[model samples]
Target: MLSGFSSHWHYLWLVAASLIAGVMNAMAGGGSFLSFPAMLSMGILPVQANATNTVALWPGQLTSLAALKSDLRKDLLPVAALASILGGLTGAEVLLRTRQVTFLHLIPWLLLMGAVIFGISGPVSRWLRARSAEPHAKRTPRYFPLFCALFPVCFYIGYFGAGGGFLIMTVLALFGVDEMHALNAMKIVTACLSNLVAIITFIVRGAVLWHYCLISMVFAALGGYIGARYARRMNPDVLRRIVVLTGCVISAYFFWRQY
Candidate 1:
């Protein structure tokens, strides 16, 4: 009843939607706002959709971490990586154990929360920048305290990552990471590690729907490459606003669909 088989059309839609999501993430953040739902619409169950989405978008985070490697706070990397792995594995396990219907019910709330956090990130960054303007002592990062703070954020990233990167940056700033590059570098590292562990968990548990995940991953990479070229020329603030708005609107739509 269509131009091609239903399966082919669905794959086409997933590819196109993932391309746009990648562009959004490269320009700003919040690609999951599109990619997760695209997986769902393809009839993947909620938990699997989430797992597949996480796996699909993970390489970009790795790419970022690679580029920022020189700025990584070496003093903080061990604890951060440990926390990310522990929390990410726990979150992925919980997601896998969750009943399908319950996860579907929680989707809107998760999306809304991610959007709200993202909306506040810009203001929080400005505050960090202003505070960094002052001369302050180089406080040694409290490893335990920093890990405690980051565990939940990385767990959330593993569960449903949209705005978790910003949360990591904010937490790092709060814990005396004064250099912007260091903060960015650490954020990417933790996020990448979080996803890496989750990806492993998903594969071990057979949660990722690879048929869709593969297409999403390839197209998203292409989109990221293309978007990165134009990102420097665009106003980041404007793009951030657009990403936040898109997340909010999509969350609202999901909420309506649920209730």
Candidate 2:
């Protein structure tokens, strides 16, 4: 009884972290940089923390999708959806089979990579925008190539999830999707689908902490609503910088912990 009580207290911060994660995801795109490390700091095993984080944030991603429904392009939907499902399932299987020590060793590098990706997102977005504006520019790559590219990205989403949206946006931009709203809309759909499969896999494997997942889900959903409503008022560039800094700090700390 006392242990359960203490466990509850230990997870209180997950609620706060998830709320902030939801807001950050809504405003910018790097919530996992916050949520994943927060769980790790609470002494959750790396794989369990990742699974729990995915379950906690899945609802919020769906909420964002609902809010961005009008922005989604039908032409880009079917193939990406298939890739997301297949890749997510494959990635979840891989994660479940991985040893805890292996995941722990890989955490720092993954976090660092995620940080670098977030840091350069703005510049990349601008470049994609310029390229999209050229009169003779190719609007999209052939469908097969785009589908192939999204496979690895969706796999990463199911495997780790941190900064996955940024990766998705980068791929979409390369596919000639330069409109900010449209890119975000596709990101939301793909993330939601990918996370859905991951969540199912984690649940079946008993990797998620149900109590923590439930609490975080509620708070994240609330944060998503508030963040979406106030998105225009927030400076996304500032939020992006903060996320990048936080990712760097978390990565350094995890490196120290692991080594």
Candidate 3:
């Protein structure tokens, strides 16, 4: 049995981290920078921590998908759905098979990659937003090409998603879907669906630590709700910068920890 005060502090730490993660997610879009590390700090194994983090943050995406369901393009759905399912399942299975220490060593590099991707997205997002107002003829994207573009990113999402959502949005924009509504909607659907299968894979493989997962999920949900209320009042650009900075800082910390 653990010492009483120490155990209480551990839970309190998780609660604080999860609340901030939820708020960050609702405000900007980088909660994993907080929640995933919180899982690691709890002494959970690397693979299980990643799986639990994915599971914990998933419910929020469902609400987003529901709210944005109307904006989803029927044409793109087939490609996004197929890619997310196949890639996510494959990624989760691969993660499960990864040796614990190997995953541990990879944490810094993965976090760095996510952070760098997020930093680049700031410009891409603005470009997409500006491009959204212009009218363009509808173009049909080939299923195979679109699937090829999305599959590896979806696999990264299932494996250790931090900033993969923007990558999906970028891919969609490149495929001639510049409208933010559709891009955002499809990103959430792809993420939610992909994460859904990974969640199942982790659960079946017995990789998630349920007690922490449940707590983080509940508190993160609460945080999202609270953050949503104030999201409109806050400046999105500022929030985005903060999130980017947080990801980079966290990535650096992980690098420091490893080396």
Among the numbered candidates, top TM-score falls to: 3
Root-mean-square deviation of every model: 1.5, 2.5, 1.4
User: How would you encode candidate 2's per-residue C-alpha lDDT over 86-144 as one tens digit per residue?
Assistant: 98999898998899999999999999998998899889877766765655433545778
Cα lDDT of candidate 3 equals 0.91
What residue pairs clash in candidate 1, if any at all?
none
lDDT score for residue 147 of model 3: 98
Q: State every prediction's TM-score relative to the real structure.
A: 0.96, 0.89, 0.97
Q: Evaluated with lDDT, which candidate comes out highest?
A: 3
The sequence of per-residue lDDT tens digits that candidate 3 reaches over residues 140-182 is 7889999999999999998998898999999999999978899
Residue 23 error for model 3, in Å?
0.9
| Runs with alpha carbons beyond 4 Å of true place in candidate 1 | 2-9
The number of clashing residue pairs in each candidate reads 0, 0, 0
Worst 10 residues of 2 by lDDT: 132-141
Candidate 3 or 2, higher TM-score: 3
lDDT per model vs. reference: 0.89, 0.84, 0.91
Model 3, position 76, has a per-residue lDDT of 85
How does residue 107 of candidate 1 score in lDDT? 95
